[model samples]
Target: MIQASISAVPGLIVSFLILAALVAAPTALVAKARSKPWPLRTALAVYLVGIAAVTLLPGDAGLESWQCDTGMPTRLFTSVSSLLNIALFAPGALLAVFLFRRPVTVAAAFGALSGALELAQSAGHLGRSCSVTDLAANATGALLGSSAGALWIYLRRQSPGKPLRDLAWGMSLGALAVLAVGGVFESRIDRVDIVARDDQKRALAETAVQADEWITAAARGVFGSDTQVRQTATATASVTEPDEGGCRLRITATTNHGTISGSWPAKTLESARSSDVRADEGSLGAREVAAAAARLAREWFPQHAAGSVQRVRPVGHGPTTVYRVTYRRYAHGVLMPMRLDLTLTGTGRVLGFAAETVADPVLPPVTVDEAEAKALAQGAAGAPGEFRRALLLARQVRGVWRPVWLVGDGSGGRASGRDVAVDAVTGERIAGEISGAATPTAATGGPPSSR
Candidate 1:
């Protein structure tokens, strides 16, 4: 709070000067017809300016534009200041209605002002979201103030002395009711900085295939011999080139089961052990594949872990079809973030598998469900980083799978988003993947995964 007040000074000065310039003429005119206009209008102006400064100022950086900013996703309405943001504007609207004796005009004008402020925050890259919900809350406060002021005016006419005090008491009672209703509001997990589109992988696949620059054999062997394999490679060589930390490539195979994607560098292939067709006594299905994968990916297994099938799909066409089995970690009904995927050819040959790892010993409780975790993820998207979405997953650490929330932003490729992992239960940020424009801290650093 102290830091907030101190930082708000610069914003307050600027907001006051700008607002005064825009409203000086109207304010001057109102002063002519009103009693105590100067003091009241001045107070209203101060209130308006103060609210603006408090809400929008003290950004992470100075005078940022869209091009240069990069911010993390921020959760909204989770702090005392957020509530204060709504309350601070109420007095100004009340003062305006008192001055102009026009509740509707004051309410409508203040509502428009609130909208404009939200718009500016979004467009101006001022380190805040142009949230529709915030606008509604601001407008609601203005309306509440207008009602109070108008009621006070009415009561004054009906009973001259102590009318304002009576109105204040009534409003206090109403405010209590509003607070009671507001108690239900909770902070939601929102996924921000998402993949721009699903088609993003398509372009990379096309390019790697066109250039014939990526590994096709590993995917072919893993996804099945006859499944049609498509691959794409990208790195951070130049603005138009894929050439970052070497080059990462993705192999997508369309099989009869649906689609299976494998990613790695050609030389640094993350090799996997596959099963022989004759080894499995049971028929092919989600359950059969999951059981088989559990054995193959036993290195990732924990004494406390159990496996459930997330999906089973047949992709590709013709002579060979690969059934992709996605086996996920589970704790009771809650899905853990850790996963192991298995693909099988028509002949029941194991195609390949990939699994996630967790180095952190901390496993969060399941306090936050998927819905709330998702909301938190979206709110994590920050400046220049529009929130895309979040997913709940478990990362394997010391052979134990822990629940995690994966947050992402818009970048590109498999590793392109500003990604962060959070402890699902504790709401504490866990260092895992840092993919967007920012560099990873030492604790969160790891080899960038392909998918």
Candidate 2:
């Protein structure tokens, strides 16, 4: 998590400097007019600009609607990122106290500022998630900074500037103002409530042992045997409702170098990032990335490496290019449920890995042909388009995994394209969740033939 945060610092620094330059001259003039220390006021302005740059300006405006995260951390200071959030607002609060001469007022003002910024992050389409945990951390930092400022004033025998009655009035008004703003914005944002679950009815020791085994394997594969891997948290199990009959146990473990997380029993590597594979300073071509990823996939899954269809696509354009590689296996021209997906940087550093592991499912006979599936899809969609590709894959229907024909125009593959799944046995349209299994397309084959 710390490494992920560190990777973003360069962009944050550039944005902060640009915002600071725009505000510097006006900030200095205001400080001089107020007879306060110009340097301290300038610092305060720059610090606020840093906050804006970090939260509001850095990310792309891709969000379609406002979102609010109502989940709270299980514990405070849960990670390095949470600690950094606390530190982010402390300096601003400290500076405000010295400039405004009222510690309580400064803290309240900072609290309001944090709330307003969070609202902006959500409603302004900044592609940032607003969380209650962050708001709590920012408020805590403001209080701590204000307390330190109050202590300094006491030690110096300086007047605190406001009487008790006036201080109470100021705090009450600030609270009311904050409440008003929050009430206005609450109805506009969508609240996302996250619930944590553990449904694996097993002994704690057993779960820990299983998690340790997987974590050890992943760490050794990504880093080496010598790296010190530690279980960051207890493994948790959640019920998976797919046709695949097993619950998923998610294990998160951190090495001294990086973090690795995956599911148990299935023995799949969900994601792992280490400092071992440093990102390349320059961009790499798509072919280079695909070749590197293919090599790694072959090395990791030697048993299922042959006769798999590989697809490589580049995501995000910048100084670095991250490639998304997917390998889909097939049996006798029918797409298998098993799949391997990898996300790698231009330097071939593996940022993510997800492999779907499933035993060979007993498939029903294919009764509906590709042409029938296309006609059914055309009827369902109520519009006509050139249907070029038809692929055979498995989909879940009424709690059973069945062979289904995916017929589409070959636009975005099976996942996002104008595809329709028709149950091969019953010739009925499959309408719900596609399947837990990954779907393969006609990218590696010729025109569809009768099954």
Candidate 3:
């Protein structure tokens, strides 16, 4: 996590510099005319501008909605990003204390500023998540900064201005204000739930060894053989029922470069970079990108090499394009639950990769035909719209992976559109919400004609 945070500093510093230059001269002139400490005041002004620039600016317009972090205060220091949040407010609070000669008030004001910034990030659609842990970290930094300023005044034999009583009052009021702001933001943004289930079927040491092997292979395959990758945190494994009478191990391991999270022993692996790598100049066509992605997928998941390319679409484009290439496996002419999705840059650098490990799934025979499944789905949705395509795919329902008919209206393509999944065996409605799997494109190939 620290490595990831360090990698982001260069970009943040560049944004800060651009905004600081615009405000510095005017701020310095205003402070100089007032016979105040211009340098410190101007520095404070520039710092505040930097805060706004990093926290309030819009980012990744493709994000769907605002998210909130409700992690405990005890977990804050474990993340280097949280530590950076504390440092973001320290200097400003220290400056405020010196200029105002009121440590308590300075601390409270800085705390309020932190709360306001968090609220703005969520409300202003800035693509930054609101975090309670950040609020706590920032307030801690303000208190530490103000205390240092007070100690300096005491050392110089100057009036250590604010009384202890003022500290109590200021903190009480600040707490109330921050709580109110947090409440408002919490109601407005989506909360992220972290579940820690105690259902480990494998030993911690065994999980660690498996994680090491996977991460080592992933780093070598995704990044390069020369790149050294080390796990930043301990690996964890939990037992999950993917089918009746069968349980799979879900393993997650974080590394200096990226994260490796998925299941094992009937495995799935999702390797994602902590930050975007610099893409090469120029763009590649969809077919070219798909070809490159197929090679990478084959290397990592050899079992899925026989799978057909379901879709190839450009998700992001600029100096280089980022393509989403999807592949689905089939067993005896019926789509298996196995899938591989690779997000690659135009130069074929793997930004993200998700693939299911191959295992001969014990699936029930598909009794329901495509026509019957589509009728059931349309009846459930109460819409007589024509389904662009109907495909037989395996879906998990009630802890069991079973064959299902995925029928879509193709109104919003694959990513944003709604689809219905009907159980191929029972002819029951499985999923009547947004489509979960990528819809096959005509350019690549359609689903099996038998469907």
Candidate 4:
């Protein structure tokens, strides 16, 4: 239980703190307003907003234990989770309802707020999920809170003018109880460092996959896809050790996405650097190329997408040197995806960038309304097991899809094969044996199929 509390503590703490303020502020106003509809309505409104903020602000994806990625045969309990959500929120909502006479207004406010939270998640604007299950759960919580309030009102009406102090005590005690219960599920503090290089970014990602100890060190707990950093201090690597010149970089990321204090190290920085001061004029250098790409990319994304640009120097480049820039963009929903990659060059010049778009394969096109991209993606999964595992290991990448001309499949298999180019945003294929192979063309820089 302590372990569970520690893991989920972050979300829980934020949720409860916000909930407390919402509960106290509104209840006080509602109490002062007496039977008036406005005060209670306003409180409900604030509560809903609070819920949305708490749900979204945390970068960590709930608790590590909360997520079970067993691979293939995955079960997304939209229904069960939804039910649990209702159980979670219903009590508070019912309490609010019982405390007010305007049940209809409360219901409307609760539903609208729940819907808005879900929409934020759906749009992928918020880090949290926009789940139908959450909507249902929020609604249920609101209803239950309101109902409890209604019951209290009914009992109070029996005594007519009995001391108002009596009611105040009960409400106060109830609030305290809620707060106490919340204490059991708070998430601990976590710190994470966001690096400026793609290879570094992936190095951290790989650590999460390859070394459990590494992740435990970085996060202070079992890390998950959603481990969040409350505050980040940026430090430019003062010196890049030439010996650690592998494409992947090693960084320390600390998080508490687990039951106990788990300090873990995860590698993050990754990129290609110039082997030496080269004189290849026409061939743009990695840093210079990345900068130019970032500028172009910023111009390319949907204006509304939330993003940031980071400047990175290849280890040895000194104070006067201009390094590469990495561009990161995040959006909402199951389709709400985030893409991160390079943009600028070593000379601080513009360069091409890489991007990834994570969207539900079934969502129809906003432009041509073509076939569902998700279905097409799934069809490429090769098999059902592959389909199930794909979700767990989906890695979107950029780069022109290049065809490995006449590539041999080995094992006395000399059939021509097209190599799938995976850059930074979209690439997921289940392993399977195929009889023949097709030649792959250089990525034209569009969809996976185009590659």
Task: Highest lDDT: give the candidate number.
Answer: 2
| TM-score winner, 1 or 2 | 2
Off by over 4 Å in 4: 1-50, 62-80, 143-451
Write candidate 4's Cα lDDT for 1-451 as tens digits.
1122335336666565666676667666775678665655555555555554455554434323222111121122344444556654565466456444544445545665565544444334333434333544565666666656666767877432233543564455445544542232223212121112334665656654444444333342122345553332223243223444434323333332212121123133222122123322243455555545555444333321344333343433433343334443211211123343443334443232334433212222132111232333445533442111111112222321211111112222322232221112223332333211121112111232221
Estimated TM-score per prediction? 0.31, 0.45, 0.44, 0.26
RMSD in order of candidates: 24.0, 18.2, 18.0, 23.6
Q: Candidate 2: misplaced stretches above 4 Å?
A: 1-10, 33-36, 60-64, 194-451
Best by TM-score: 2
Deviation (Å) of 380 in candidate 3: 4.0
Ranking by lDDT: 2, 3, 1, 4
Candidate 3, residues 179-239: lDDT per residue as tens digits? 8886786577676532111113434446657666765666667766655665534434444
Per-residue lDDT over 1-451 for candidate 1, one digit per residue giving the tens place of the 0 to 100 score:
2134446345556665777667755665677667445767766765666666655664653222322111221322454544555576678888887877766666666776776665565557565544444555677678888888889889887432354554565466445534532332222213233222223465555556643433455445444456443433344222212233434454443444234343443332333444333333334655555555555445333421344444556665544556676544444433444445556665466755555422223445667765665566556543455445455555543344566666665244232446766667787666544221112122122212312
lDDT (0 to 1) per candidate: 0.51, 0.70, 0.66, 0.38
lDDT of 1 at 294: 54
Error of 2 at 423 (Å): 34
* Candidate 1 runs further than 4 Å off: 1-36, 55-58, 61-79, 125-129, 157-451
Clashes of each: 52, 0, 0, 101
lDDT of 2 at 422: 80
